[model samples]
Target: MRKRYLITFGIVLFILVIDQVIKFWIKTSFAFDDPSVPLIGEWLQLNFVENQGMAFGTQLGGGMWGKLTLSIFRVVMIGAIIYYILKQIKKPDVKLEFLIVSAMVLAGAAGNLFDSMFYDFIFRDYFDPCISYNQVEGSGIFSECSYFGYTEMVEVRHRGFLFGNVVDMFQFNVIWPSWVPWLGGGQVFPAIWNVADFAISCGMILVLLRQKIYFPKEKTSKE
Candidate 1:
């Protein structure tokens, strides 16, 4: 691959890896069932969050069906971006930058999708504390709940399909004064996101800025 393409891919991969690592750590350690843990007194916190789909802290939902549909749509979109990038390889000099941006966007989208597709199978619900699954006092709570299969009080709240819901965690809030009159910051947003989000953001910013600095010049050949 060319240098530009490699750089973009590298950045995308780096962001994806870091994002997933942070999410996995939180999944194993924190209990987001109760978010809003106090960190740095009241500013930052280690909270685990899951979103059905959407960018950080936002979601479009009509329930599981909605999420599944969105997930499928995203899969198609990302696939298209990847295809576009591969096609651009035929004209490396002309299409390097486009390839880079598209690849980063694709990678970011895929990284988050990976979480939505698999996290549910391995872990239980996001709202419940992990302790609920641990075998307290050695007898094994699941064994204790063995009657679930035959009992009338069986309440099974299972995590849905891998793509059933997207993994979203990463909410950055900047508190502005309420006295500003017309506009003051409120609660800000919903879920916490990961590095994939950052990669996409950076790629988009670069592409937007690139238009001005690298915009094509009109042909001024021999007249």
Candidate 2:
């Protein structure tokens, strides 16, 4: 039991650290118009982008309210997953693989949740060229600022807690062929995602692939 606990903690910690490190590096070093850095030829590249809502750049709509609701939902889900893991850990028949995957999912959720809770406050100096604003003193209202060159931009106004955008950098540079119906010359996977998103996806996929092993069917009395 102690070994299982340690393994779960280690996996979650390792994933969280790697995910946050990659996100922080990309957020601080990359600019909006920077060219993508190819990792494996032109297939995979590092392209910086941010999303205000869910994974794969999906928006929940309703603007600020939507962001708040999504963040709250993530918190609730994380808590529930933790509870489930704890209960399962005490069960003699619980599979270790299940626990491992669950930990990865938890870590991924936490990594993104951390960004939503604090990135805006921490990365205020990372300016966005699209909307220039002059923040009103003591009030959160931001007035438009005069446009100059993109180089001479002011720090972005903070968006309060649970309102920061999630940083995404990795992208698959595959584009659909022009002959493809209704999907010509578009990226096969248009979404730019980060390490946290990758971890969550991999964990869920593994669980699905090995569901029977992780969850064995109980034999009936007659059988």
Candidate 3:
């Protein structure tokens, strides 16, 4: 039981650290408009982008209120998962695989939540030419406008708690063949995601694939 707990804790800590390191590196090193850096041929690349919504850039609602709601939802879900893990750990028949998957999910959720809660306050030096003072109607938000043939420094302000954008960097450059239906000639899995998103997706996929092992059916007593 103690070994299992240590393993779970290690996995979650490792994932969270790796995810945050990659995100911070991209946030400081890459510009939004910078060309994607090829990693493995033309198939994989580092494409820096910020997601203001959920996975794959899907928004729950509009503007700041929506972001706050999403962040709150994540907190509730994480709390429930933690409770479930504790209960399962105490059970004699609990499967280690189940605990591992739960840890992955928990860590992934927490990783993104950290960004939503603190990225705005931590990352204030970022400047983008596309979103300048005149473009956005706000006082605290400002950027250097080199894209418009002019350049100027502007004061930067935090976007407040739970309103920071999630940084995404990895992208698959694969495109669907023309023979495909609606997605013909379009980028295949075009969503730019981060390490946390990948971890959550892998954890979910493992759950689906190994459901039988993780949740074995109970034997019925003879009538």
Candidate 4:
């Protein structure tokens, strides 16, 4: 039991630390809506933005209440995950893959939760308050810019709990040619996300890709 928990904690802690560290770096180093700094030409770029709502910058509803509801929902989900993990740990035949996948999901959710819970307290929002979700107004990646960390002139007025923005940095600007379907040479996969989002996405993908392996069907008593 101790070993199982240790492994679980190790995975969650490791992911949380890395996710927060990178986000911290991006948050402190660059401004919100900063131009895309290509790491691999235009294919992969570092574009900083903050998500005040759901994953991948999607808005949950409208105002502060919507944000709070989303944050609470995430906490509920995290609690459910913890309960599931604990129950599984007591089972003798629990699969390691399931545990790993759950850990990934937990870590990712916690990472983003931290941002929603406390980032507003720590960092000042330079973005125009009227511009909700930083919704893109124009075409192409160059149209956006990120705010560097808070300046002396800026005041850090934290939002009432669980109302901060989830910082996103990584971008894959895969613009297909004009002939390509709806893309029209525009960016494919336009959403910008962070490490936490990646972990959750990867974990879900693993479970989907290996559902049978992770959760094989049991033989019937008659058989």
TM-score of each: 0.69, 0.87, 0.87, 0.83
1-223 in candidate 4: lDDT tens per residue?
A: 7888989879999999999999889888997656789989878999988877667877777555667788999999999999989998898888877888889999999999999887766765544543345333221222223457533222222265797788998989888789988869788889989888998999999989989987789978985
* Model 1, position 10: C-alpha lDDT score: 77
TM-score comparison, 2 vs 4, better candidate: 2
Give the candidate number with the greatest TM-score: 3
lDDT at residue 57 of model 1 (Cα atoms): 37
Which sections of candidate 4 miss by over 4 Å?
124-158
Please rank every candidate by lDDT, starting with the best: 2, 3, 4, 1
TM-score of 4: 0.83
Model 2 ranges with Cα > 4 A deviation: 127-141, 148-158
Candidate 2, lDDT over the whole model: 0.81
* Predictions in order: lDDT: 0.60, 0.81, 0.81, 0.79
Q: Given candidate 1, what's the lDDT at residue 179?
A: 77
Candidate 3 global TM-score: 0.87
RMSD of each: 7.4, 4.1, 3.6, 6.7
Worst 10 residues of 3 by lDDT: 129-138
Which 10-residue span in candidate 1 carries the lowest summed lDDT? 133-142
Candidate 1: pairs in clash = 57-191, 116-162, 117-162, 169-192, 169-193, 170-192, 170-193, 171-192
